[model samples]
Target: MLILGGTGDATVLAVRASEIPGVDVITALAGRTRQPTVLSENTRIGGFGGVAGLTNYLREQQIDLLIDATHPFAAQISFNAAAAAATTGILHLMLIRPAWNPTTGDRWIDVESNQAAATVLPGLAQRIFLTIGRQELAPFAHLQAPSLDTRNKSLLASQAIDLWFLIRMIDPPPPDVAIPPGKILLARGPFSLEEERSLLQQYEIGAIVSKNSGGDATYAKIRAARELMIPVVMIQRPSVPSGEQVETLETAVAWIRKQLAIRA
Candidate 1:
């Protein structure tokens, strides 16, 4: 079995799958983070080039089942996995955590994409807590205070909210990337509500920008926002290819067992 993995649930599934008798599990990592959580199963890092490269790998390895346990926003890899499975005539399944929904007292402004979220930020608040990962930070960089002599006055005025961003990510951003005026917090998640509240207070965050990457690990921030009555600019997830998807690890494990049993 080949599992395309990156999320915490993926790690759980990988560990569970490794324990099953006669199942050969291999987990693939995207290598985005500097130090990824180590998986007990055999692991491969980096991309497979593209769809063609992935298809070639599936054939060469003679994989029986392919499980896409990638991040929900990792649409390209998910699509490639589906296409590669189709080409190889192997069974494919997607294991994804469901997207988050807003409850009462939650001030969430949903936007189609990161760019749209950036466009909406200045109107919402001046002090922003940007929780979206480092890769997507470029879109919001324009929110930084511009030079006084700049000519585009209207553009400057519209963007001139003088936003201050607080970026939180596990890895430090590359030096060449242009980032908004902000302090970066280098940390991993499963963060506590107290810690999140402290962060919001420390930064005096008026608004928060985050992707709807649903799971409990980073959810404290959302709860903190709700408690503080802070508005959140949520970037909606991209659509992924349709397939047999299981939301829970038990169901995924059962599905894998069924496939392995049939093959056995």
Candidate 2:
């Protein structure tokens, strides 16, 4: 079995699936980070080109099952995985976690893309807490204080928006990339509620911009934002290729067992 993995769910699935008797599990990462958490000794890092390269890898490795456990926003790779599985005629599964939804007292403005989020920021708040990872910083790069000559605009547009962003990411983006105008906070997830609240308070964050990736690892920020009454600009997940998907780890395990049984 080959697991396209990078998220926490992917890591857990890799470890659990490897423990199944008589099964060989290999996890592949996109190699976006300098030191990604090693899944096991059989892990391979880097891309598999595209659909063709992935199809070749599946054939050469004699992989019977292909599991996509990538991040919810990793749409392109998910589509590639689906295509490669179709070409190679292998059992494929997508382990997609549910997206987060707004609840009571949560000020959520759902947007379609990062570009939309950037467009709405001027109307939302001045100090923004940007929690989207390092890859998609280009959309927010042009955010800056508006010039004084634009007095004809409405209050939301004429507020002299000194756009300050608190950009948080696990790793710093490539140096050549143009990031938004603000301080970058380098950190990882599973943050405590207190830590998230303190960070928000310390930075005086009036609004937050996040992807609805939906998992407990980073949900603390959402909880903190609710308590602080801070508005959130939530970017919805991008569409992925349709496929047989299971939400929980147990179901994925059961499907694997059934496939292995058929092979046996």
Candidate 3:
């Protein structure tokens, strides 16, 4: 059995799966997170190359079942896995966490991409707390670079740099942003309100950027920003690729049990 791992729910499900006798489980992580949770059984870190590579691996490993338990934002890998499963004829199940709904007093600015958020940034405010993923950081390169008009005036105007981004992510982003050293903050979250408040205060943050990755792990920052009356540059969850999705562990367990019984 193969399970895509990293999500909190996925880890919980993996632990439960490890309990089943005679069922070998292999969980794959995206290798994005620094302090990832330990799986219930054998674990593998890093990418699968692509669909072709995964297809070949599936045949060689003779994997019987595939469980996609990756984060909601892990779209490309999820798509690749789906393609590999279809070709290899491996039984596949998706265990996706549900998305979050907006609550009262939440000032949300829904954006489609990192660039979109950047476009609105100048109007929103100068100081920003960016929390989009590591891989997604490259798109913000232009923001990191100074404008042509500003560069001609003086080095001090460049030095002043009204627009600032306080970026936070799990893994190291590709070296492309070229942002000033003082601007970046490499940290993981499940951030406490106190921590969030302190960070925002220290940075003098007027806005926050986050993806609506539904979970409790990184939501305290949003609440902290809210208390500080800072706006959140929110990106909604992307639609799931074509698949049968299971939300809760109960359903996933039942589904897996049925599959195992059928195999038996």
Candidate 4:
């Protein structure tokens, strides 16, 4: 089995399925993160060059099945998985975590993309806590970065482009990136309630921003903000093309087992 594992659920699923009686599990990680993890029995880091590299890996490794449990925003890799599955005649499954839905007392501001989220920043609140992950932040920076070169007035209609951002990503944000001063927090979470509380007080955070990466690991911040009556700005998960997507580790394991049983 070949598991494209990077997201927390993907990592859990890959690690759990490694114990199957006759199955050999190989997990490919995006390797954007440098932290240590309890991954599967066999692991390879970094991208597989695109569709061609991925297809070659599938064929060379004799992978019988492929599972795409990547981050919700990893569109290109997901596309590669779809195409490779078709080309190699191997089974594929996508494990997508359920997106967070609205509930009472949740001050949710929905945006189409990260860029849209950036645009919404001015009026919503200036002192914000952003949890939209490292790579997805590019859209916001692109919209916000000031350059003297040419006119890109299309994105400047609102003039709300001057809003400040306090970004907190898993890894240290890119130094080369153009972010406003005194606005970057280098940290990872499952942020503790106390920690979140402290941050809210320290930063005087009026708004919280996040993606619906549903799980206990990183939810404390949201809870803290809610208690403090801070508004939360959320970016909804991107839609994945139609597929059999199981969310939990248990279900993912069961689905893989059923596929193996059917093959037998």
The candidate that wins on TM-score is 2
Candidate 1 lDDT by residue in tens digits, 23-134: 8888899999999876654899999999999999988888888999999899999999999998888999999898999999999999999889999887678789998888
In candidate 1, clashing pairs total 0
Residue pairs whose backbone atoms clash in candidate 4: 190-217
User: Which of the two candidates, 1 or 4, achieves a greater TM-score against the reference?
Assistant: 1
**For model 2, where is the 10-residue window of minimal lDDT?**
148-157
Q: What's the candidate order when arranged by decreasing lDDT? A: 2, 1, 3, 4
For model 1 the local lDDT of residue 134 reads 80
- lDDT value for model 3: 0.79
Residue 258 in candidate 4, Cα distance off native in Å = 1.2
Off by over 4 Å in 2: 145-161
Candidate 3 or 4, higher lDDT? 3
- Rank order (by TM-score, best first): 2, 1, 4, 3
**Tens digits of per-residue lDDT for model 4, 195-225:** 9888888888878778877777777887787
**Candidate 2's residue-wise lDDT over 1-264, tens digit each?**
999999999999999999999889999999998889888779999999999999999999999999999999989999999999999899999999889989999999999999999999876777899999898899898775553444664354354556899999989899878888899999988899999999999999989999999989999999999999999999999998988999888999999999999989
Deviation of model 3 at 36, angstroms = 4.8
**TM-score for all models, in order of appearance:** 0.93, 0.94, 0.85, 0.86
Winner by lDDT between candidate 2 and candidate 1:
2
Query: Scored by Cα lDDT, where does model 2 land?
Result: 0.91
Report lDDT (Cα) of residue 16, candidate 1. 95
* Residue range with the least summed lDDT across 10 consecutive positions in model 4: 141-150
Q: How close is candidate 1 to the true structure, as a TM-score?
A: 0.93
